[model samples]
Target: MHIYSSHVLVCSGTSCTSKKSPELIKKLEEGIKRKKLDEKIQVITTSCFGLCAEGPIVVVYPEGAIYSNVTLNDIDEIINEHLVKGRIVKRLLSGNNEGNNSYESADFFKKQVRIALRNCGVINPEIIEEYIAYDGYQALGKVLTTMTPEQVIDKVLDSGLRGRGGAGFPTGRKWLFAANAKGDKKYVCCNADEGDPGAFMDRSILEGDPHSIIEAMAIAAYGIGSDQGYIYVRAEYPIAVKRLNIAIDQAKELGLLGDKIFGTDFSFNLELRLGAGAFVCGEETALMTSIEGKRGEPRPRPPFPANKGLFQKPTILNNVETLSNIPIIILKGADWFKTIGTKKSPGTKVFAIGGKINNTGLVEIPMGTTLREVIYDIGGGIPNGKKFKAAQTGGPSGGCIPTEHLDVPIEYDTLIELGSMMGSGGLIIMDEDNCMVDIAKFFLEFSVDESCGKCPPCRIGTKRMYGILKRITEGKGEEGDIETLEELAETIQAAALCGLGKTSPNPVLSTLRYFRHEYEEHIVNKKCSAGVCKELLDYIIIPNDCMGCTKCIKVCPTKAITGKIKEPHIIDQEECIKCGACLEACPFGAIIRK
Candidate 1:
């Protein structure tokens, strides 16, 4: 075995890779060789460090000194000053201040408690040996060697792990149902079709820690008494799919995946199933249908997947994030896992925080962490000093959380109580500039488009709701439109065939529940309060503020702003396209949308 005096861990996660961390890696290697420290020092590329705002991160082990925002130029300095001389590089170190103590006191990592993300930035995901070094397959070994299927299910049941994939169903109970179902040919399915917008928590896990999911699936297969497993990953995530394939190949080569037993009687095999980018397939039945080479549509449930699943046999399905937690729960013991979060919702949740936030990336926090903590402390509050208006959780099937609920604990029940859900953990922050009605319409449009046309409630009902939202946003809303929306939302919620239809009204319903005043303004006053819906807005020139720079006139596509240089500009309302190019192009505070 090759032994090194020190190890250089560089982040090769998607965010860092986009920032050229791979090139940075090459530079470090050349620098190490040039300094004649190649034998003594080792460089390893790993996964996300979570502090993505400071990307291209490097951490030196045996000293645990973390460096942020590293470039090719800084590589030589790190190699010469730190690797050879055994000194810390001051400039590259993280934290608010600049010293050894400062790096340790960094605010970025101080409050975080890594459980699901523990192995993310620590090991090479493609290499099984490195995974083994980090005790990757230890859980599988323990389960296969000692525990029975019933015993394994019991352990998970005691762990208090609910499914992280939107619905928050108890994972152990799901497994138990499949285990009890008497079927000669049972299977395990992994829901990797992460269709939610801005939700890449599952994708990151697949990219950075593919082996974890693979191992967890093996554990689940054993628990569910299944010999075959299929991972239904979306085709959109090429990187994640590539890494997942690599991990599966590596695991199979190591005798961990294919008809292999780790030398036990248990034998399980896994395969990849690609999705054709249908958002509706995020639902289990729809995902199964897609995997079976059929149109992605949800079937009626009662004989749920546990009773009659893949190939019409008993099957257990768990999402990527839920599977990611399985090995850890089994390895550490259920009691150990249960101690982390709230009693009902134990364990950590990975949230993809994006849209109008300062720190836009994946975050793993305990289930009970407050929205204020996630938005203010971790997300760095709303960007550019804008007041936080609301947050949209659960993508199209979820609701908007108003500012009043910022302090609410972010568990499954809490969010549902507030008219949102823990739907796949896509927490999108919205600032004061966002219009509530427009936001609802935007999500409804997505829901309408993604509806599989299988159920009338989801297909036609969402379309009708979206049309109403469109009319309201366009200043053509009637006084009865609000009541109509409410009636339609309730009808859809009660009558929809699957979860996709049932939860499709969430955005409209929640926005109406919380921000009805905005709707009233758009309908009764014929004005969009946030000035987002273009049809209800008219861009006018504020003559007092206009500098007459003619920049807006030159940039306007419709020649709306007509004025000579050095004089106040005037907007020709008849020619105005309402594209807001003038508003965006105006350097001065000249253009006002009213």
Candidate 2:
């Protein structure tokens, strides 16, 4: 094996790529080559480091020095100061200098358990040998060599590995059902169609460790007696698609896929079918429908995918994350895998944590990890020292967890009990500055626009709820608007055709459940406490904090502010459009939202 004194792992995930990580990689390669240290120093491009806020992350191995927010200029300094000279560059360091600035000591990784993301930042995904070096296909090899199909299913079942795709179904049970079904031909399908807002768990997994997915799917095929599989991924994920294609080609070349895998009689083949970015296609039926060259829409269940699925055959469908865990479960016994998370929900969950948070990125915390730890400890608390008002989990289909339940153990059942489902792992943080009514409206608008119109509850009911929220935010809410929203939500929840329609009203319902007072403030009092709803806001000049240098008057979008040069400003409520231009213009803390 080739040995190097130092190994450089760089972030090539989507977010970092957008920030010109590729360009940064080019600079590093050029610098290392110029210095003739390429043999001594190895540079590899890997997946996300979870701390995406610090894009273009560079981690120096043997030293474990993590450099965040790395730019083209910072790279030369990193090479000269850290790589060649053996001196740590303090400026580009990720964490604080208070002893916890190092990668191992950073608060970001304190609460994270990266099982699905095990090889993400450690190895190059494009190179199949790097994956093999990390024991990537060892699980599949073990399965094909020693374990029987029944033993594989039993092991997964005993592992308590529940489906990571929104609904928390048992993974082994789903496999068993598909395996038991009598079909001339069965198919294993992967749902990489992660349509949830602020969710990128699956995308990161595919990009970081595509081989794991391939290995896991092969294991699943062996377990469920399937020979052909297809990954229904969204077309928007160009990078994931490219990596998956490369991985498949590599696996085929090594005889890991295609036919007689590992010299066994079990022969399997896989293909990729791209979707048109339909939110509804995230549903298993819709995903299958899209894969079959039809318009993406959810079909009636009872004949679930496991029984009669894609192309009228027994099909087992699992999300990207759920599949990523399969190989590990096979390698490590079920009992071993069950020891990590809670009894019901075993294993780590990858969450795409974004919005109003200090450290915004991906995190894979254990199942029973508390929201407080995930938000305060892992998320690094809210930005601008804003008080954490609520956290929206499960995206549009899930509910909002208010501050009262912040300490609740983050398990599958607990989140649902608190009125939110543990969706495909999107935990959006909301600060005190957010208006709950507007927040509800934002998600409702997404639900309304993305609705397939297959059923009235999602197609029509979501539209009605969106309209009501729009009216409420605009200071035009009626007396019984809240009651109407609740009624519509309940109806949608009951009468909807699929999981998408049934859970479509979750955002509105949950916001109404937790932040009812905010709705009351908007409708009954004609005010927005969080200053989010523009129509419900009243800007007032705090005379005590005002220095009054004609700044407010000059900067007012409308001629609302008028006062003498040395005197405190006066805001005309009638003239003020509540654009808060005067607020932005004021150097002093004078402007207040009333």
What is the lDDT of every predicted structure here?
0.90, 0.91
Error of 1 at 305 (Å): 0.9
The sequence of per-residue lDDT tens digits that candidate 1 reaches over residues 238-300 is 998998889888888888987757888788888999998989898999888888899888999
Model 2, 500-594: lDDT tens digits are 88998998888888999999989999999887889988888888888878888987877888888888889999998988888788888789887
- Candidate 2, residue 397: the lDDT equals 92
* Best model number under lDDT: 2
TM-scores, one per candidate: 0.82, 0.83
TM match of model 2 to true structure: 0.83
What's the count of clashing pairs in each model shown? 0, 0
lDDT of 2: 0.91
Q: State model 1's lDDT.
A: 0.90
